[model samples]
Each structure stands twice: as C-alpha cells, then as structure tokens.
Target: MTANLSTPPAIPAGTLPAGTLAAAPQPRLPAPGGLLLRPWAAADATVFLAAYRDPEIGHWHTRQPASADQVREWFDRYGADWAREKGAHWAVTGGGGEVLGRIALRGIDLDDGVAVCAYWVLQAARGAGVASRALTAVSAWALGGAGFHRLELDHSTRNRASCRVAAKAGFLLEGVKRSAAVHSDGRHDMHLHARVRDDGPPA
Candidate 1:
C-alpha cells in the first residue's frame, strides 16, 4: 500500500538491534527517470485515499476498501512502524509530485535481518514501468542502506502482474507455497521470490 507521510513519526536510527537479520544501513538512491520515490508525508493523504479507493489497486492485496478516516488510521499505524526504523513506506509520484501509487519495505523479520517488499500502481500508471522503477529504487536502498543481505516478495499464483513486478525488480523466483494466501474470495497458491544482496540491479 502507498504510505502517507503526514502519518508522522519519522524513522529513528538504531531502533533495530544489531543481529544476523536485524537492522542494517540501506543504500540511498536518486529517484528514477520520469518518476520520484519520496518519503511519504501526511499531506499526501488525499492522493493516497483516492488510490486506495480504486478497486483495481485495492483488490489484489490484503487491504480492504477504506474510508478517509480509515486511511488516516492506516497512516498512523505506518508512522509507528517508521518511528522504529523497522520498515519504510514511499509515495511513487510523477515529476511534479503527482501521487501515482504506494510502495513499501515491510514485514521486517528483525531476528532474520530480512524484509518483504510490496507495491501497487494506479490504473493509469500501469504498464509504464512505474512499478519496476519503484521496486528497483527500494531494492537498492534495502540491500545497501539496511545491511540486509536478502529480500523477499511474493504474489498470488494468479497475480501475473505482481509476479512480473517482482521479477522486474530483481527478485528471483524461489518457489510456490501452495494454498498459502487466503484472499477475500478464498485461499490461493502463492509464488515466492527472493533477491540476495549481490543480485544485480532490477532489469
């Protein structure tokens, strides 16, 4: 889901412990061409809410349709995560700061020193390489800045678009976890993918 920066509570340093899979410095990066990957801000709530309300963006992930108040609450919870440096959320935008979608490095397993990544793009932004670029930007940051040696991403077996995004972001197909995801409709198989630190940039 796209994160709202106005959510408050900036990510703090050293909040994560030094362990095999705990906190590590991630690499910083410049925004991709034709796109910007910026830290989320609270003022972005309207754009975020609009994106979420789009059924195309909302249906694939676990997020249910949300109201404006619900969106605010979501940002608050995400802010708490950021404050601890346990994860990060970014707003994917156009050159002039038009919100296109949301991307995040979440589900950090501090003990394992790894994290899972997820992203979504607005319907209009689809097929424009927005997702691929965002994924690359975040992946670089995760591996370089966070000292995280490994990253994971997964998509439902039927979600070809997501699977493609994962691959375009440099994640290698690990395998499938049969009947692992319980979607709104029912359970479904999941395709797991991983990217080691040494993997080259997302193609």
Candidate 2:
C-alpha cells in the first residue's frame, strides 16, 4: 500500500530510524556516465512531455501526457511527494545536466519497509545503460542509508528489457503475478523482482 507522507508512517523493525527518509537534505546523487539524480525542475517539463510520448513509455505506463501543463503538474507532484514524505522522484541528468529520464522509489510503505522502484529513459539514451545504472545506484541508497528493508520492481512479462535491467541490478526474480496489471495493450502478467536490506546481489 502507499504511504501518506504528510504523516510519516511507523518505521519497520529492521529499517533505519524514524524520519530517516523524511529528514535527509535533498540533493543530487552522482552516478556513472556523468549522470546526476536530482529532483525534477519546472524547466524539464517539456523534456518530460517529450519522453512520455515515446510509444514504449505510453505502452507500459498508459495515457500519454496531452499537454505541457500535465507534465508541469507531474513535476510539481514530485516535489510535493518529497515534502509529504510519501516518496522521492528524480530526473536523471547527463553530464551537462540535461534531463535524460526519470527514476523513482514510490508507493513507499514505511511500516513494511518497502518501496517500488521505477524508471523510464529517453529514446536517445536507451541503449546506453542509463536505466540500469540509475536503478543500481538508487537501490543501493534506498536499501542502505535510507533504511529500507526491501525494494520491489515489476514489469509486464512482455518487457524483456526491463527484466534484464532488474537482473543486472541484483534484484532477485520472485514470481509472476498473473494478470496483475492492465496496460494500453491489454491485461498483462507482471514479473516481480526484489532486493532486501542484507541480501547480496544476485549472480
């Protein structure tokens, strides 16, 4: 279930101390390929709009953003999410700090010590392993200092590329949830993966 960040939930038993996620100073997280994970800015609304138009992004996430206002609203929501302690979302930026994609740890359930991680890369950056690098870096931070016990990720079984990303980032395949979600195409089964606080990277 989703967390109500406006009122931080009870911390899980083995996770980090209470207020750990809510109290941290927001900043950019350095990553490979000169990538920096930072909060999305209003300036990136156009880029955000462009990325969601990619057929693949629309295929999975469903509902293409029809206007600049929608994207701007999404950007605003990301900020609000952090303020409410509900979750964190970042714009994946390249060396020059151009928005390349987005990555987030959402649906945070503090009492259960879990969050669902998601990412989507711009078409220009697709083959460069941006999603994988971002995923690995964020997962490490979430499980380590953030004091999360587990991070979950899922993709439609049809999304073979995402499955590869999860495997490369050390999340273990749990099982398939039949007809777990609906996409633009139709009802789809979801392949689940997870990483626990003390679990080693999957080989």
Winner by TM-score: 2
C-alpha RMSD of each candidate structure in angstroms: 10.2, 6.1
Q: Which pairs of residues have clashing backbones in candidate 2?
A: 5-84
Off by over 4 Å in 1: 1-29
Q: On residues 102-153, what C-alpha lDDT tens digit does candidate 1 reach at each position?
A: 7888977665558888889988889988888888887886677655667898
For candidate 2, the per-residue lDDT at 141 reads 81
lDDT for 170 in candidate 1 is 84
C-alpha local distance difference test of each model: 0.75, 0.85
* TM-score of every candidate relative to the true structure: 0.81, 0.89
Error of 2 at 182 (Å): 1.2
